[model samples]
Target: MMQLSVAIGDYDRNRPLIDGRAKIDGVDPIVMTLTPEEMFFRAMRHEAFDICELSLSSHTLRTARGDAPYIAVPAFVSRAFRHTGIIVRADSGITEPSQLKGRRVGIPEWQLTANVWIRALLQDEYGVAPQDIQWVRGGLEEAGRVEKVKLDLPDGVRIEEIGATDTLRDMLADGRIDAFMGPRAPTTFVPSNKGLRWLFADPTAEAMAYYEKTKIFPIMHVIGIRKALAEQHPWLPMAVYKAFAQSKAIALEHLSETSATKITLPFVEEQLRRAISLMGRDFWPYGVGPNRHVLEYFTASHHRQSLSARMVAIEELFHPSTLETYVI
Candidate 1:
């Protein structure tokens, strides 16, 4: 009976994680609700909770100069998740990356992966550097403060501290900014309500293109374990990953039943079905091998950003050396 404190997003994304089936199937569920910023804070502080699922963008915060030894999970396309995208006002004459020159772009947080990846894409593919565009950070108001995430920004980006999502929405609606960077759900909702057009969406095909070209898997989430504890209980890592994979399989089987039983907000059956289609069986594996592309990308990016001067051996990041690796 492992007392695992696995961090998950808000209620909407966490419903499936806390089901009785998980507990019965061997995951002592202790739930914590926090934004990505807060999770970054907890990881930085090296909180006692075991097994944290954090965004790759927050990996910098987690492994900051003096943090505990933790393994980041590979960035994989979860069975039903999509990459973040840039949303622009439809009629604003901003239809492509080339038009973004001199226009303002908003990011939920400066440290967010979508923001950085999109920045890299803009620079690499379209000859747009950080200096060429107005980068506005939508985050907390206290100077240099976010929930738990800290950002060390490069030059040529502007910062506009916002306290909440509504403030960001107002800003977007008022034309204070030209475009915003965020996950699909958050960015699409407000703009759609206002009939604002999505200038472009980096769909799954685009994600596959980036990977095929760069071999960089945009890490979405990583699960870390305290090094000492992991040494003491070597089996924990595989067990945890196995549990999630199994639970996901169970979730897929009872897609309709799970929705009916839980009735959790916003995660209706239709969404589950879509997620099932998106996160195909291949993306979810019983062991570490399934997310190789994600791991490779993180290793390269970490080195590229000079976040780590040395490349990480993939084996060092996973538990149970014997677990066979596979890619989807």
Candidate 2:
């Protein structure tokens, strides 16, 4: 069996594959657990791993530029609604998304997948376009953060980097920036930093309503394999895809055990039932067809945000081997 290294975040759906309970056919994967920040930087800058979970926005930009070194699989390892990711200062007077116009906003990266979705939502739902606000880019808590890849921002949009001694968290806490957007809540958003509050007081309802209307759960990352490896071993992508699917299947099955809860959360069964009712039994689906609409929408958004020169077709993003498979 061929040996390869895979870098991905540890999550319930991928834990089985990482721990070896689910195996990829004819491949020996040396799994390296890493955070998304380290993993994306290493993969893009150094090609450090043979397989990795890649930011969909970055991957789309690379693909559009015709320089991506990996072929993506249909496995979506991370997905979340980003309405909750937007936070504002309690004194900023930015109570809604529309109020963000002409305000100073902080973001970890302009091309981050989460920020891409959030920007799209702000534009589509609230008529707040990217150029409407001044953007400040910097580290969330620490100084000296930079975008993993170069960006060519659209004309009329103003984005400036924070000073070497400054950070987004500190700036937001001190009212230097009116709002912040990224995947995680800022370190200053805790109770001690009472100045910070979510832009939407209750983002859950907004997220649910967005999902119910658009059917987009917002895919954050996609599985990527080195292009040479995929070319050399034509079957590798399918094997990896099947293994990931099986792992997620096992995780979903475990969630169905109502007799005793495996997680610490209260009312797990009730939450699961509510999710199924809202999104049907296959809420978290894998593969291309089930997620084509989301992919298309994100690609359009990426292009609109000036990350991609043009909209990339979903067919160009995934390997042919993993596109269609027998079911049963």
Candidate 3:
């Protein structure tokens, strides 16, 4: 068995893989639990790990250019609905998505996966196009952040950088930016009482409505294998896919153990039932076949948003070995 380094997040779904309950076949793996920001930066910039959780938007960008350092598997480690990504100044009076037009919106980076999905939501759902608003880019919590990958923006799509010392959290609080949009909410947000709040009065209701309408649970991160490693070891992709699928299956089984809730939060049973009713049994599937619509939709959004060189085909996104499965 070959020894390989794997860098992934510490989410419950991935715990099995991290702790050896699930193992990548034919490989002795060393795992590092890392933040998405750190993992993405190191992987994209330096090829720091043999396997890592990659930002979907960054991967798509490199794939479109035919220069991706990593060949992805269908293992989407992070999935979320981006409705709660946008937060507005409490006094801004922005009650709806449409109201975002002509306002200054702060984003940590334009090329972020969550930002791509949120922008897609605005354009496709509310007819609010990207160019319709002024985009201000800066760090969410700190200052002087930059895009992980260089962007090839479409005409009329522009992003202005904030000062070297400015942070989005501070800007939104001071009303310098009308709102902040990204996967992470600004620290200023306080439910029912706040100087900052979600643009939607009830983000959960909006996200539920969106899922019912579109049938897409936006994918945030994908598991990637170094291009050279996958090319040299032909079996690596399928092994990685199967292992991650097994890890997720374990998590699902644990989630169903309602007598002793595996998750830390309350109402696990109620939430699980609701999710199952909405998305069915294979709710958070990891394979390509079960998630082709999601893949197609995101690729379309990426190309349209000027993040990709072209509309990348879903088939071109993953290795062939991981694409098809033999059913028993």
Candidate 4:
């Protein structure tokens, strides 16, 4: 059985396939799930692993900066999901991106891919350079654990490292921080519970503009195969991609149509139904067509940032086998 590692955080939206579910039909492959942070580091380090899902902004930037080996996922998959947003307390005085100045901001993990992307958004769209804001990073720091990388502060900004989501909620409730950037549900829901509001209901324009200029989207959660492994077993990529495709279809069907069929695990029918209602239609869908905007934005923003990297060609990332099968 071929071995691959995956990273599926708490969010069910992007959870990787597991159990027999992750297996590619007609081929034997075992898949393992890693924490998001670990997956990012391992992929960058180019450690032993067949397929890995990476963060588009933080992980891909490091790869572009020559820190890791080049790994690609199909372009179609990249297009489906793109963009991250900033979350703020409801009563805070911060209204626009400019208001973020001198405020403490909560990030899920410092130096993670999302943080990197948020920084890019601030720079490209908001004109708030990374060197200008206080960044608060979060993680679990209990006994027998290493202290995570604390956020680095720029001039006139202060950063504090805190552990626990409860701390973040408390901070927001007590006005300890001005805003946070994260996945939509957590960022919006948690803050709303504490009387916080999304600072920007729509943060996709800047990202969309970036995509219009460049073809490459900063890749997040890519399932990459090492050159040697792909060479050793040429069909592995196709098999894996197809399995993910099937899983994606299943997820979408679950969202659009309802049944007593008990599709998604642990999440009961009512709960899943509620989640679908909460997310609406565009939140999750099969394939990457929806996220094309993200790549376009990344390419344009990278150009502006002086990265000088070529726009990622669609063919460079995806193989014809998976593309054709899913494209129709």
What overall lDDT goes with each candidate model? 0.57, 0.92, 0.91, 0.54
Model 1 clash tally, residue pairs? 8
Write the residue-wise lDDT of candidate 4 on 77-121 in tens digits.
Answer: 332223445777778787788888777887655444445556676
CA deviation > 4 Å runs, candidate 2? none
**Residue 41 displacement (Å), model 1:** 3.3
Local accuracy of candidate 1 as per-residue lDDT tens digits, 1-328: 6666776554323345656454323457677756655665676566645767665655544444335356644323232223346777665688777898888776666655555566666776668776777767654222343434444445455565554453455566678778777653343356437646555564567666665575454555656666676678766666665555555666555545762555546757665565456555443443446556655665565545444435665665555532464459
TM-score of 4: 0.62
- lDDT digits (tens) for residues 91-114 of candidate 3: 998999889999999999898999
TM-score per prediction, in order, is: 0.71, 0.98, 0.98, 0.62
Better of 1 and 3 by lDDT: 3
Q: What's the candidate order when arranged by decreasing lDDT?
A: 2, 3, 1, 4
**Of 2 and 4, the candidate ranking higher by TM-score:** 2
Give per-residue CA lDDT, model 2, range 120-215, as digits (tens). Answer: 999999999999999999999889999998899988898999999899989998889999999988866887777888998889899889999999
Which is better, 1 or 4, measured by TM-score? 1
Error of 3 at 142 (Å): 1.2
Q: What RMSD, rounded to one decimal, does every model reach?
A: 5.3, 1.0, 1.1, 6.7
The worst-scoring run of ten residues by lDDT in candidate 2 lies at: 185-194
